[model samples]
Target: MSEDAPTRADGDRDLFDPNYRAAVVDLLGALAYSELRAFAQLAKDSELAPTLGHTSALAILAAHELRNFKLLTDRLRALEVDSEEAMQPFVEAVDAFHARTTSSNWLEGLVKAYVGEGIAQDFYREIANYVDPDTKSLVLAVLEDQGQADFAVAAVRQAIEEDGRVAGRLALWGRRLVGEAITQAQRVGVERDALGSLLVGAPGSGGADLAELGRMFVRLTDAHTKRMERLGLSA
Candidate 1:
């Protein structure tokens, strides 16, 4: 904690070891896959929008996602990691999660994106702190919400203002998404221990209590529920 002493990231003197590279590569690949899938989901979800403006915005946002996907994938290739293969392992989990909680309406889609991406950003922000300086910055930089949560929140708010009746269904939809998302996240944990160890931070790293990963997940869900409430959706 002192400026005089060099900060210790892990027990190893070199933090950029093979395990770290694997973790970094997988992490980047995961994000690239996320962007690609979000592009498709956004396009589909945008169809539920009654307004042309909202729908067009979704298309624009989807473009942003593809652009990001390109950047991340390029970085993965530069690192000599097979971007597709790195992303393959967790694809089923993510795909199943999205499918199980597919949104039925515009507000539902926005709520899911806003709520889901918010929680994911929290996890990524924590991960940004766990890695070495370059990777920490990279992680922080990739934690994107500009084209997703921010846009979705405004659209949802405008929709609610225009049609107050949507509150009931969107609220229920939000809750269901929160539930399904955590379910998928738990499944991801079982399947991807690296994430739990990294995003959750290592057990002894002077970071957060890795043992409290479950509690942290619960806390994120709780906060997301509060966001729903703030958006006029009951928990």
Candidate 2:
């Protein structure tokens, strides 16, 4: 099997369990909404580009996000879940996350696009490990990085090189974005029991326990730190 393909075990058959199915639906719904929001936000942020080349790059990234959104919603439909209805529960929390982390300028926007989204994708990828094989594959595919990381890193690093002061300011912004992302993630897990149960381990849910969840956060933090380093900023 390809390295990118999900490893299948006999346990993957648990996908048919009603509880596991519901959890997968909730996961797909949340992912679908996130992709849609990314598309809109990337398009808006493209307006902050300093040059036509930057503008075109961000526009391409925005298009990728829209395509990813369609992939997720299509998966939800195949499960017989109403895409909009499934996504509705997460709208408020996700919107609030963006509202709290709104960027003040082009560089800040680049940092958020890289750091904020990176942490969220890391968290989802970790969770994917606990799901059935097919659901795991879908989640991994949707969460794949789509060139935004490289673009953001190059842009932010160049800015920092041009103005040393840019590093300090962007470091602070990166910290705020990570904190807010964590808070919003916790809120979602609290409000959405099915999603939470995937980590907390509902009966027959085959989810990770509390210990695993703690370690998951550690991995997330490490990833954020590396991302910050790539941007020429502190974590």
Candidate 3:
């Protein structure tokens, strides 16, 4: 987390599952790290847009991610988890994932923002439900507030209307993003089994089995590809 970015402070008092405490802490920490990095990436990538309208909206959206990061970080601290320590190792994992799949242009950036943010929201929604009610409520509340996905989707749709051929490259890029996501997920499993197990076993979240998670991942990929097709972009 950036030192200058304002910390989001929420009530520390929330019911939680003691057995799954580490998983919850680590999940929030990892999620927070992703948000922080995404903001930084968007802030940089937003300038790549041709229009001030696109750049300005992305910058403002990037700022909002900081708020969510602060909220998640504060929650980690309240749980007596070391926010920095928990988030540290993941910095590389999440950052590397983004670095490897960076957008080549503004439209690529927006498409990435759309597909990436949507999947992340879905993943978090699944994870949050498995935790406790307070954590669930807080996570759900935060989920409701993310506008980046909406903005990204709209931006891409508009961009597609301007140039139809951009779809093939962007769709390919989305596939690459999905590929890296799966690779990093495997990395996460090796690095953090407990969290992975929680993801696998926590009721209906993420997966009932590895096959289920695989199925869900394929669904997300197909949805992204469909998004491309809908935009007059070829998969």
Q: Which regions of candidate 3 fall more than 4 Å away from where they truly are?
A: 1-19, 202-207, 229-232
lDDT of 3 by residue, 112-225 (tens): 666665566556666665566677786787666466656766777777677777667777887776667656655654477656756577543333577877776676567656
lDDT of 2 by residue, 40-81 (tens): 999999999999999999999999989888988877776777
Would you list the clashing residue pairs of candidate 1? none
Candidate 2 has which clashing residue pairs, if any? none
How far out, in Å, is residue 23 in model 2?
0.6
Residue-pair clashes per prediction, in order, are: 0, 0, 0
TM-score against truth, every candidate: 0.82, 0.93, 0.81
TM-score of 3: 0.81
lDDT of 3 at 174: 76
lDDT of 3 at 86: 78
Q: What's the C-alpha lDDT at position 103 in model 3?
A: 79
Candidates' lDDT values, in order?
0.69, 0.83, 0.69
Candidate with the larger TM-score of 2 and 3:
2
Instruction: Give residue 198's error in model 3 in angstroms.
Output: 0.9
Q: Judged by TM-score relative to the true structure, which candidate is superior, 1 or 2?
A: 2
* Model 1, span 1-235: residue lDDT tens: 2232223463342344555566666667666777678778888988887889888888888787778788777766666667898888769877887888777767777887778656655655555566667556656666655567667667777778988988777888877777777776566545666655565455444345656666677777788877786677787
* Best candidate, lDDT: 2
